[model samples]
Target chain A: MKGQIKNTLKGLMVDFLFWLYLFGCLYYLLHNNWGWTVRNKFILITAMFFTGLFFLIGDSLGRKSFLPTASTNRKWSHSVWGWLLVIVLIVTFLVGWNIVEVNPYKFFTKFRNAGGITSGIFDPSIVGYQLSNQSLEELKLDGVDQEILEKLSGIIGKRYNTRKVCRDDLKRILDEEEFRIYGEILLSKTEKNMTMLNQALTALAETIFLALLATIFAIPFAFILSFFAARNLMPHTFLGNSVYIIIRTIATIFRSIEAIVWAIIFSVWVGIGPFAGMLALMIHSIAALTKLYSEQIENIDHGPVEAIKATGASTIQTWIFAVIPQIISPYLAFTIYRWDINVRMATIVGFVGGGGIGLLLMQQQQLLRWHNVGLIIWLIAAVVWTMDMISAKVRTKLTSM
Target chain B: MSYLLEIRELHKIYEGGTHALKGIDLNVRKGEFLILLGLSGSGKSTLLRCINRLIETSSGEIIFDGKNVLQMKGRNLRYIRRQIGMIFQQFNLIKNLSTLTNVLTGKLGYVNTIHSLGFRRCRSDVAAAEKNLERVGLLEFRMKKTRNLSGGQQQRVAIARALMQNPRLILADEPVASLDPATADSVMRYLGELNKKDNITVVCSLHFLSLARKYGSRVVALKDGEIVFDGLPSEINEQKFKDIYGEEAEEVEIR
Candidate 1:
């Protein structure tokens, strides 16, 4: 009698939870996505009541119905349900379109406005002026000869023969040693230099290292947590089950928050720099890698574990000898893959004051220096491509080994 | 009688209440080679695992080496396991590890937790691992990973691994079932040698009657979770075989 009552209570709880979940989903869809204002109590209640009534009618009709032949009734009802489903799908799609506010005509009208920025982006400003120690204005104020000044202007203007013309002009005007110094100064000042290129390259290197550090920092933490999270390894005892639940819950929560959000949070805590970005990536990587590594652990061969246990080995010993061997290759593969993802994510994290080339890119973009932004974008693409290739090759080798 | 192991009134019911072993009473003398013959899922593996307390028995008393195995826990259970080695159909060697490392794992029971964590093997243990590999004729392949070895060679490495424990008994659950006939016979020959020369009591499960007849001094047949036949290998007549294996069953020779 007690058991029966207990089962009835359990069933009631499950039903209550199910209904709660259904209503929660309905409320979310209506309030967030339906476009109709559901803030008024009367409209909300009326809508919910109609939806519940329709659901009940559908559910009842889906089972037995009033008809002479049950088979024919089922077939007929199936068609009605199918048509209703199609209509519902069409309504949902239309509603989704309205909610997203997609405007195709705006693209054609706005295309002209974006032409300047697009052109600047396409024509990357890869080179910049090689500034000398002294500015041109300083030399002008120093009251140098008018011919020398004209010659300097000529050297700066003409791109093709600037170096040769300046050398010949200055050599004819000045003595040999003074001509050499002037030539050096002129060439240094007017040469097409790599200021933008160097900045982009440096930022890219910082981003790569930030990603590498994040992956490396996350490894041991993920490796240790994975054992607790794995269903097959943990959850045998009450304490183990609690540990499993806690670790799994924490990992899921961490993984759900993207690295960029974490970077923003860390930037507040640590002050904006690569350290914040690296910390954010490290936290996300730990969670993601814990999930992957635990799954790998869960899928490992039970045979070796059993064999090891039969050898009179302790639980820890079995893990070391049997479980560790099976998971090492896959773990290495996953770590390398995580590093690859971190490299891509680091660039994004930098947009939010978390340091890397992305910070430079964002600054240049806001200043409307599209050419500098383009150089940084190209550098990021190249570095990301190279890292992807290297990581893929390494992962293949690890897995094969 | 001075028996190496004793099992009384053993009953095993799985999680979903499948009765795998029902009221099994058995004893093993020292230095005996016993073969268990039965169809798949006839409780052979369960019985073997229960001997070492790998699978907890539903209700039974298992006494191994004069100690109550079922009553043992933690350190006691692990200590008991060290004396009883087990082999599986898949060989169950750590595939990514070298043959020497797989063999060295057998001595993990004797090592402390700290030592095991560091994977520190004693000189004696290393020497014994090499000796065991030599005994299995796998000394040359000790440095090779177990996955690269053939099925027979892998099984031999598993045997060498078991020998590292210096076990008094070995429980083999379909050890040669996946190997070819020639490899099966060769593997069986090694087990036979261990039984005779090392005086290690062995309880092995087999699918083939011919291999049982050759290596097993005594054969026990289970049908529907109950022992249907238990006698000398020669005592299994066609009628008895039919009774144990069902009327539709026909013996298929391995060779």
Candidate 2:
């Protein structure tokens, strides 16, 4: 009789708290962001009714054994606290939906426009890939006026008529001849894939060189810094400890920043080109590779180190005889892997004016030339695929050795 | 003046306050095979390591060849290490390295390391490494990696590497502990041969009394970091063995 009376008091307190929680959620959601409207008020009331029903089931049937094999004293989902949590989650989702201002109507409108723009870019870019005029002839448009072509050609002038036209000249030429080629593209016909191929090859070679040079430049510095960062190699003195800590902190800070940010910093420092991109890639690789190399150094068999030291070898000689032999293979493998990573990063860094095929990609993006963007993307994908194959082969061979 | 190596009250207290060795005093003459017998944690390893400065003594003095070993620094310390060879229970061979390279490492202490970095080591060093390999009867296995060698073979390779140091004193810390009885006998045979034929003073730790009596010219027994007996191996009867090793120890033979 006394336990029954206590249970009734607990039920009354739970009922009061549930309503208080609902009221608080509704007040927070409405007062801050969403306005106090009848629709929202009705939704909150319905949620509260369900929450209360869930708790009633928990109190009335939680202790009853439903299965002969199973013995459970309580149901977590049917409990008052669980029901309250479910209602809170639902309320949070609704509030977040309102905060994001998600409007399906605007998305549909832009979604339609996206189709039209994509189709337009696709048509021109695919046509640009065609080397022969056979496709253009099938368009059946009349030939462009020679007089108008002369006027546009004269604007480009003889001096600017080189195999690799300067950027400013190309822009001027494109502006003048864009309308001319709009029709001439339909009328003209011939094999001139060389120009486009040359441009692509140049940018791709530059990207590979950028990654290669950066990794090469970073190797020696990273190798030297790794010894300083290795805990066991560093002396136990205060000065030695400080040097280790400083190098570790600096490498971590450099590693934490993205390669693109480093590219931007270097681009400003060295003027927008591949040199800046190389510097950016090199700095980040140094920090990253040093950490890897140092860890490898730290984990090697100390038995060999002790053996070497016992031979009366100096510190440097000990490192040469014991440490270098153990780490050389791993260091080389890491370097090859880093080059693969740098190759991918080079393209992204170029978007920030670091120089590579990414520069062309950015240019095409800004000009709304999505077809050209697709072509550049394909170029980067090809490089990545080849690098994957090469790095894998090299690592396998190194491991076998 | 008769002593080649002298220890005057060497005390070693580890960082966690474990007194590993308590005021050990001993003297070793030139061209002697002295065996240190002790149970586990009896300071045999600590005493050997302290002699080489592998582990620092908390407070003590060690004099080697009329020079204060505790006060030696930099080049002086390395000079002493060059003369004192060490072998571990595990053999401590760089397992992945070729047996030849492992032997060559012993010469690293004597040579200028800068010139040895590339594939071309000093030509004479190569010849000397080959000579040491031949001395151990492992010249045919010189190109093979040490990991492929057997336990006794690996210990022999370790001996060969030590021979390259031209050490006046060799410290063997339970060198046969990891090997089987037959293999242990062979490794011990090699150490004994070096002690007898080369006239190298050896300070070695051992567990079995049979090997100690056979090879050791003198025996020193330690119990709880204190010297319990320091005399000829023949003098240690069953009573002295019971006192040094606790009364509970069962007498076990190694062969």
Candidate 3:
């Protein structure tokens, strides 16, 4: 009889909480979207009246056994609560539509704003002007003026040079100086393309290595932290439980923030470059891999642990022999998966001055050099594809073995 | 008779309020193959684990080899545990590791932390592991992963692992409960041999009466956390079996 009363009280508390939450959401929606303020006493009173009436009706029906019994094969859609659910869903969708200000016509209307970039991408500037290897002294003797010589000095010779000739200078150098163009333009375009390709390849290599270093750096930290975070491995004592919670909470917080956000903060701290990018990725990967590795630890077979402990193995020995053996395959699989994600994240980190092909791509994009942007994009896609294939193959092999 | 193990007023109450062991007292003599027979959840496993301090008893006195194991902590407890090896029904060998590594893990109690960290077993330890494996008839399969071995083979590997401890007492917790009838007999034969040859005090739990009678020197039957019968294996008649197992229980033949 005491248990019955306690159960009834618990059910009443749950019902009250359910009604409070439902009304709370309704009030938020009505006040924000329909201008129904708290001062609107009449509407508020009517809502309260309906809520009370509904509960009273339900209570009375339940007491009198008027509601459909569990044995009855009632169709859920035909129920009153079902209709209310459908109404709530439709109202939420309508509010979402208004909030986002959905307008499909603007897509077609505003598309031409992207016309210049689209055309530039369509005619990718693959060909570049190959600068002559003729010495500055030779150019001066060839009757080239000192000003033109200085301008040409910035664009030529250094295969890894970042500077490119401006439009006006390029036209002047190519058109007005008939002597230079007739001798240079035909053969130099391929050489110029080669230089661009070479730059792309170098940036690609930097991006991959940056990702590799970040994954490698994160592994040891994550591996050690995972033992603390794993619920099964941790003791049920107060200190152990607290440590588990602290590690889990920290990991969750780190993982919640995107790698791009970390990159932005790190780029500021470390003053930009692949190092900052690697640092950002490493932090994110440590948190992500900790969560993965700990979960694998939790799912390990308890029997081996029990057996090991029974053999009078010390904590460290038990971990090495029993726990580590079971987790190695899954840990390797998670590490490879994290490395794959880090590679993709490395390219994006560059957008925030974290440094890689993304930095080069961002610069080209801002300068309206869409063709160079297109080239960087192509290289990124190819590398990502190859990485995807390799990770997939390795993961399958690890799991199968 | 020298008592190898002594249990007095051992009571275990789980967090879920399960009165699994309710005030038990028993004494085990040296060189005795004591077979524990009981229904599932009758505290057979609870008693075995308590001997090695595997499961912390709520309130009890467990004296193993003249030392009060309940009061022992850290190194002392490990020392006591190493002298008492345990086997399980599931044959809990590390499946991903080779049979040799699994056997070597049994010697973890004696190994220093540095050697364990590097997973470097001494040459003598490796030789002992091989000898133990050969004793279990698994020396040829030492390089194979335990997962690739058959169920019976896996249990033999578990035995080899236990041998690495050089235990004076072997606790078999329903070791052959998962094996076939023939395999179960073969596994018990190995334990019987060890009991006879090495004079190891074994406290094994089992559901099968046939295996118990054949291998056990004495049979101890428990009913609802209290011993109902303690005598020679030949003394467990039909009436005694019913008293321990309850009215509706019928003895099922393994063969």
lDDT of 2 by residue, A85-117 (tens): 577679878777777888889987778667634
- For TM-score, the strongest prediction is 1
Clashing pairs in 3: none
lDDT of each: 0.83, 0.80, 0.83
Name the DockQ score for candidate 3: 0.75
Chain A TM-score of prediction number 1: 0.73
Q: Could you give candidate 3's per-residue lDDT for residues B139-211 as a string of tens digits?
A: 9999999999998999999998998999999999999999999999999999999999999889999999999
TM-score for chain B considered on its own, for each of the candidates: 0.99, 0.97, 0.99
Candidate 1: segments with Cα more than 4 A from true spot: A1-81, A130-189
TM-score each candidate. 0.85, 0.77, 0.84
Expressed as tens digits, the lDDT of each residue in A1-401 for candidate 1 is: 88656654554344333344444445556766665554556544554564455444543222222222333245544644445445556656665666778789997788988875686668677865442435455567877667666655544443222245445655765668655655666655665657677788888889999999999999999999999999999847899999999999999999999999999999999999999999999999999999999999999999999999998898898888889999999999999899999999999999997798988889888987776777787788888898889989999999888
- Which lDDT tens digits does candidate 3 get at residues A78-142? 55444555666776676676678887898779999887677656655555554555545566787
Regions of candidate 3 where Cα sits further than 4 Å from its true position: A1-88, A115-192
lDDT, candidate 2, residue A316?
Answer: 90
Ranking by TM-score: 1, 3, 2
Q: What TM-score would chain B of candidate 3 score versus the native chain B?
A: 0.99
For candidate 2 chain B, which ten residues in a row score worst on lDDT?
A: B112-121
Q: Which candidate is the best by DockQ?
A: 1
Which rank order by lDDT, best down to worst?
Answer: 1, 3, 2
Ranking by DockQ: 1, 3, 2
